[model samples]
Target: MIRPGLTFKLSILLACIGVLASGATGYYTYRANRTMLVNEAGQSLLTSTELLGQRFSAAIDDVGADALVLASLPSTANVVQTDNGLGANAPREQLAQVYASFMVHHPEDLQIRLITRKHYGLELIRFDRDADGLMRVEGNSLQEKGQFAYVFDTLAFSPGRIYTSPITVNHEYGTHAAEGKPTLRLGTPIADASGTVVGVVIIDIDLAGLLNRLQSDLPSDYRFYLANEWGDFLVHPDASKTFGFDKGRRVLMQDSFSATKPLFDQATSEVLLNGLVQPGQAAGQVLAFVRRPFGSSEGSRFIVLGLARPLQDVLSGATQLGNRIIRMVLIFSVLALFLAILFARALTKPLHILAYAATHLFAEHAMETLPLKRTDEIGILARCFDRLRREIKSQMDVLHNKQRELVHLATHDGLTGLPNRMLFMQKIEAAIAEATRREEGLAVLFVDLDRFKQINDQFGHSIGDKVLAAVAHRLTQVLCSADVAARLGGDEFIVLIEGPRSAEAAPGIASRIIGALNEELLIDGHSMTVGASIGISQFPDDGATAEELLLNADAAMYAAKSDGRCAYLRYRDVIEARKLKREQASEGATEGREAEPTA
Candidate 1:
């Protein structure tokens, strides 16, 4: 056997340690750098998306304000007064000059027309750009705009309020807008001095231009996406996919990004997503943020704005950073191992202490004394071990935090932040066992928001969401801390009331919830009132199981809605009476038919 020198043995040992330490440090640093990069990108994109939504809204509002201002101008009233321009002189020069100057300042205004309700809808004074983009008054080219939805829709709106038409191609015959460029019509009901609806002042907005204006100041690498209320990609980077509805293709943002499906539903206003962005690409992924700009606002159908960047582009620096760190680590490892061999004799005493400490490696500050006593390569090794332990603990803590977040998101409703159907059912199962063991009564109230659909249809989904949120808040306020309130998706919510005395307690609680929600909700400057119909089912009385209770409560709620909404009803009492009445009515109708004629 060859008796090797102490320095030679130490050199071999430190060399082995350096290799392992380099690999461990390199991998940990790489992972940490990548995570940090992704996190920074997420935060940056989220903030940018929020800013973009605000900027988009401000852009639309500016155009709407301008249209209102032009509508209020004296020249607009003059043009409307001269309906059927075949009559006395209409002073067309002043109106032309007004539109010309306004169009000059707001070059995106494609066409500004004062269309009077003459011959159904007559363009009394039309201001449009020529083929060369020069402002011109086409009074001689007057045409009928009665068939346009924008004209008819505006006539119905309150005066001074702008009603924006759906974003679509300019198919109208006499528009200055290019044949296939995306366009939106902003119409303001022009009422003269006497509050009489005279005509509609319409402005054809170049949607493409508006979007470009919104994107002008953004990063060059960032891509913009615009979708309508139905998720149709109105503006896409791929021009072929833009206005896919007009081509009968039905291309949707959700088809590519399922995470943004709820953007229009108002359930998810803003969300960060990561995935294959090119419609059909495997392996590669990009990070994107989708946000709805028109949050609880009137005018203009909902338009969702999304901004996305390639993930690799975001993490470009991480690779370089990792490489540099690995190289530095390798150089340091080589140098430290060389020095470790020179100090091989000094390592003996500390090594003895370390061997003793290593026995209790998992103990708190196990090497505390070693670090304080030694000032050699061994001390450096001890400090590195301590740092590694802390790093491992930190990573473990991060993993645990992520797990907790995942569990929370899994159990809670995205909207209203209430317990979802699954979680609620689980709670009900537990509550049932508890109630059974204690011989106590448990009541489940099924609540369906009444007139919610009407609000969504009449106003918009944004306003509807506000009303739902407000109603949820009010319902929460009326419930005791022990009571459990959960959203069963859509307009349905379930509440589990404990320790109910008699059947009246459930009904009383339902009544208070109904009354609280029925109070006026001021959403986006609109005073809206929504109500709920609640159905009560008690444990061991109406139903013994969660499913049975939920079903019976739902049936009673329907009865409440049928009888007259904004009311609460008990399961058996309300349903049986209605069934008996229906049976009696059926019997009477049968008797009448028998007594009448045999056809």
Candidate 2:
């Protein structure tokens, strides 16, 4: 059988295990919750990115349609008029009014330009705004401008039906240096009534505004860039600063090239690899490119629109979610620790009480019972201890009763059933201390029966015992409840009177005791009478200690015996004189005997 102490130790071990297990479980749960939160955040970022891309594409398409409308206007057409004088003298105000109307219709299109092809070369009669908000005329030979060189050299050599190229241009008419601004240029042959091409109409649509507006709707952490087919930076939100003057020039490329360089490398690679316009790409596969070919052109006019988010930013919410999960787990751990301590204390409280009770078992004063109040194993142990306590108490009671009997036998006279000499002296000491404490008087009376020897000699020891019993009974009757009457030995007795009112009180009690003993008789049907001589000593006057009191009382009793052997006497001057005389007579008789005979 396992001891209670060992059982308590095992319970503590099990409780520790439970705490550790709970902590482990809480940590696992926290980690799982954190992972789920991060994954959900990543999914949301991806979804938002796709929606923003669609919105940007729609915005660009809307702006492109408006530019196409302005290109179709006859007033802005590049055809030469049959009547040159009227056409040349036509009011520039009338053309300005038309341009103003176009600007009002397309509020987001920041700039529009018109270029005309002539037999000599390409003449650009462009209406563009300067910083002063005035429309300015820009003219360029088709051979001089690199932007129009693609139209004049390539298409004019091949003589395509209509040609368009998406180009990034710098509007240098103003001091602002609007650098790396993307524009869409459309070139169409101006056909006469006989179907001969007289000139080409060129439309320049500023794509910078469309790209800027598209970038504005993107999230703050996101950045947008448009690059040409050669991986050259075309339209960036910071294009004016990053591509201004000589800056970022090494990274720009013309529109016809396909091999990507460093700056537009990500866009070109995404467009080529994903083939965004291809039909076979999976629906859920993340596409980094969206390609739209412009103006029925083949390769040169294709706009490779790349849309992507940095993997870091897209998964940033995962980091936050993980941290949140960790924080929650930490909080849960703290709570678990707190609860564990509380539960451990609650579980151990009963065991502590039981242990305390068990410790008391070896102490000088043991507890009567264990104080456990639980109903589990601890309570059962307490109940067992209670039973053990009962058994121990039963044995203690038996031993105590036997000890009391032995003490009584050792201190009492067997025949008279009165206190023996040892008990008498002890009682005398107690009485003296009590009288001294109370500042009162106590009387110690030494009692001796006068005819005790004669009764024993004549009627045998059995009759002598009856006489002693009778005298003891009479003494008990005469004494007050506060007095102790003890048989010193045989017929010698002592009575202790506590807190006597006066010396006269002792005499009255003495007289009553003598009278009661004189009336006691009828031992074995033989009438008997005995006289008791009692010598009284007063506390603080006759004696201050038990021995002194007892010796003085004995002296007084002997004096009573010397006087007549019947009446009690208090030790006084007359008794002292008689005692002195008896001592002197005994000495003289001893000297005479010594001198007269050697035998």
Best by lDDT: 1
Residue pairs with colliding backbones in model 2 are none
lDDT per residue as tens, model 2, 214-305 = 56766665545455554455654455533332353445433322322322433432232122123243121222443444453333444445
**How well does candidate 1 match the true structure in TM-score terms?**
0.48
Q: Local error of candidate 2 at 19, Å?
A: 9.9
Which window of 10 residues has the lowest lDDT sum in candidate 1?
275-284
Instruction: Identify the runs in model 1 with alpha carbons over 4 angstroms from their true place.
Output: 1-29, 87-90, 135-140, 275-286, 293-300, 324-599
C-alpha RMSD values across all candidates? 29.6, 33.4
* lDDT of model number 1: 0.77
Question: Candidate 2: where is the Cα deviation over 4 Å?
Answer: 1-332, 338-346, 349-376, 406-417, 433-440, 524-526, 576-599
Tell me the whole-model lDDT of each prediction, alpha carbons only: 0.77, 0.60
